[model samples]
Target: MDCILHTERLTKEFKGFVAVDKVDLRVRRGDIHALIGPNGAGKTTCFNLLTKFLTPTSGRIVFNGHEITHDTPARIAERGVIRSFQISAVFPHMTVLENVRVALQKKLATSFHFWKPERSLDGLNARAIELLREVDLAPYAHLTTVELSYGRKRALEIATTLAMEPELMLLDEPTQGMGSEDVDRIRQLIKRVSAGRTILMVEHNMSVVSSIADTITVLARGATLAEGPYAEVSKNPSVIEAYMGSASVELVGAH
Candidate 1:
């Protein structure tokens, strides 16, 4: 398999607590992978370690065959590893189109040049609108971000992430607080936009994971408990006990 990203003995520690312990993750190129576990299972910590948001105590991270364990978050982003936050991260006061344009500005080398005339950014509008259309937010492009529904706001966030043209997009909890309809919408949007890219997501929605993720890694107490497809990992005894503490409840399509 062609792995776009992988880690060897990736570990992180805080004082006496180990947040992430010796995880070996292999994310195949062009695949939608999921990291899942109960709360505090080190899913987010693993993400931080991969993105260089947090330093690893001991490990090596390779992206597209280059070791990036010591790279800064900016450096990682430059290599096309972009991450979205658990919370909605758009400019709430700005128009939806403007929010996406702001992200696109970085590609134009004008992200920090506020003194430039606003029309200097007009060249980015067409691309920004295309990103919005990819996430189904083009119809809401003229509206202020604050006026959007929560799910639409998340969709806009995806648009902004897309503006970065990420090779590996790490989405943290993409459907955390959405209703069923919104969850399905975001799920479909993710599927649609993943056509030519790789996605590694931290998600608790089992149905979403089962339907979309090509691979699933289950963590427990800062360690990998299982790694495989949803059907295989969901039925693993250790993963079942780690999640529900009982064999009766199935993990597949539970949400």
Candidate 2:
């Protein structure tokens, strides 16, 4: 399979501590790759590095055959790599349709033009509504974001991310803080969105990872402890030891 994202010896250091040690990561095109680890295992740090939120202390990050280790976050995003659904990314006061339309504005490079007539930007509404439908948020189009439930809020964010037409999306814990039903909904949403695109997610929920992730990478102590499908990685002694007592509990229902 062709790799959409690749990292070699990716490292991040804070003073004397290495938050993310030399790590090699590869995410295949159109694959849902999950990065899993225990607390303080540097999963998020590695995510930051991949998304260019943090410069690597040492390493190379290549996306779609271009080296982006030193690229700015905006530059990386312009290359079709986008991070989604940040809580702050949505404006609670704006209507759901307005929120998505704002995101479309970013792609149109008209986000800064407040003087433009509303009709001038009407072209974006159709595309924004299309994205809303894609994420199942079309019904809530005219509702204020604050009126939506937390789960729907996340879905709205996904719609916003889609407006960018990303080829690679970095999602950190898409199902975090959700109930079982919400988890399932988001899982299906993620699957729905992964078409023709690659997703790299840092998630802790084993069940979610098992069901949706095409590939899983386990990290321990800021290093890659294991990498493969969930079934293989789950049985690895090193991974079991890292999760210890909770491994079986967490992975019991995982296939």
Best by the TM-score measure: 1
- Evaluated against the true structure, the overall lDDT of model 1 is 0.93
Encode model 2's per-residue lDDT on 1-255: one tens digit a residue.
Answer: 699999999999999899988899999998999999888899888888888888899999999999999899999999999986334368999999999988899998998898988888888889988999998999999998999877788888888888888999888878778888988888999999999888898887888998899999999999999999988988887788688745554343432
Give the range of the ten consecutive residues with the poorest summed lDDT in model 2: 246-255
Per-prediction TM-score: 0.98, 0.95
Runs in model 2 lying further than 4 Å from the true structure: 85-88, 245-250, 253-255
Q: lDDT per model, in order?
A: 0.93, 0.87
> Candidate 1, residues 27-76: lDDT per residue as tens digits?
99999999999999999999999998899999999999999999999999
